[model samples]
Target: MALVRVQNFAVSLDGFGTGEGQSADAHFGHAGDRLHEWMFTTRWWQPGGSGGVDDAFVRQHDVGIGAEIMGAGKFGHPGWHEDPDWRGAWGPNPPFHTPVFVLTHHRREPIEMAGGTTFHFLDASPAEAVDVAREAAGGKDIRVGGGATTIREFLSAGLVDHLHVVVVPILLGRGVRLWDGLEGVERDFQVESTSSPSGVTHVTFTRTTA
Candidate 1:
C-alpha cells in the first residue's frame, strides 16, 4: 500500500497554518505570504531561487504522488460553491498533475484542468476520502494537500504515515491552527527538526510502529 503523506506544509510559529480573514484578495489573511516565504525562495518555485535545504524539501512535494486530497479552503476562497464558473485558485494549468479530491459539502462535477489535475468534490470524512484517494492512486502514494483543518482531521484519524511541516519564524496570533486538539500526536511519530539559514525550521513526523 502506498503511504499517505503531507509534504512541505507551512505554519506560523504559533502553530497556525493560515491567518484569519481569508478572502479572494487575501488568501493567507493577515499572515499574508509570511508563512510561505520560505518556499518562495526555493529553486522549485523560481529559477534563480536558492537550492538549499528549503528547496530540497520543496522538490519532494510531487515525488511518487499519484493523487491529492485538499480542503475546500485550499481549493478556493470562501463561498466558492456559489460561483458557477469557479474553476479553482490555480489557473488553467494547476500545480497538481493528478487526481485531486477536494473535501467540501457542496457537490459539483469534476473540473479538469489543462494539466492532469482533476478536481473531485466530496463531502466525506478524512478516512473515507483517503480510502477513495488511495484507490485512485493506483499503488502510488497519496499527497494530503491541506489548509490546516483537513490535515488535522487526517492526523487525528491516524491515516497519515508521514508529515513534513515547515515552522516559519512569524506568529499568526489567530487563524486556523494545525496543532489544535492534537495533543500527544508526537508519540505516534518519530519527530525530527532541521533548521535552515533562511530562519525556517523543517520538521518531519514519520509514523512509528507500536
Candidate 2:
C-alpha cells in the first residue's frame, strides 16, 4: 500500500508556514527560516553525527523516499516562468534519490542529478501528478514535500493520507498561512505521536480513512 505522506513540514504558531516576499535569497521569507530549525539540527540532517531524537521515525520516512511531489516554487523559482539555469538549492546530489514530480504549467525536460534524484516537470493537475508519483514510487510511499499552498491543494482534495507538522515556537507577523483556505473542509486526523525538542514540537497526524 502506497501512502501519500507529508513529512517534517514546519509551521508557525499562527499556522504560517512561510513568510511573504519569497525570492531566491529570501527563500521562505524574512523570518521563515526559523520554521525549519528543528530539521536542520536533527540527526538525519547532521553532516557527520549519529545520534538524535526521532532517528527511527526520520529514517523510516525521510530516507529512501521512492518519489516526491513538489510545487514549482519548492523545487525551482517562485512565481511565474522557469529559469533554465536554476538547478536547485540542494547542490549536486540532493537528499532524494528517486524521481521528483514538480507541478508546473510550463513544460521542461526531466533533470537528472548526480544521485538517483531526477526532477520531472508536469503540466498536469495535482491528481495527475499523484498518479505519476505513485508509479515512480513503486511499493514505497509517495511523499508530498510541500510549500503550504501545495499541501493545501492536496488536503482540500482529500488526497493526503498522513501529515507531519513540526510547529516551531515563533511568530511571522504576516506570511503564508498553511491553513489559510482550509476552513469548512471536513477531515478527521488522529494524533499519531508528538515530541518536543529544541524548542519545537513535532506532531504527526494520520488521516482517518473511513
Candidate number of the best lDDT: 1
Candidate 1 per-residue lDDT over residues 128-158, each given as its tens digit: 9989998899999999999999999999988
Candidate 1 Cα outliers beyond 4 Å, as residue runs: none
Error at 124, model 1, angstroms: 0.8
Model 2 per-residue lDDT tens digits across residues 1-210: 788898888888888878888888887877656886666665777876435554445565565468999888787547535567777778899878889888888768898998889988898777888888998898788899888889999988878888887787888878777887777544577765565657767777687764
Weakest lDDT window of 10 consecutive positions for candidate 1: 35-44
Q: Per-candidate TM vs. native?
A: 0.97, 0.89
Candidate 1, residue 142: the lDDT equals 97
Candidate 2 CA-lDDT value: 0.78
Against the reference, the lDDT scores of all candidates come to 0.93, 0.78
Candidate 1 residue-wise lDDT at 57: 94
Model 2 deviation from native, Cα RMSD in Å: 2.3
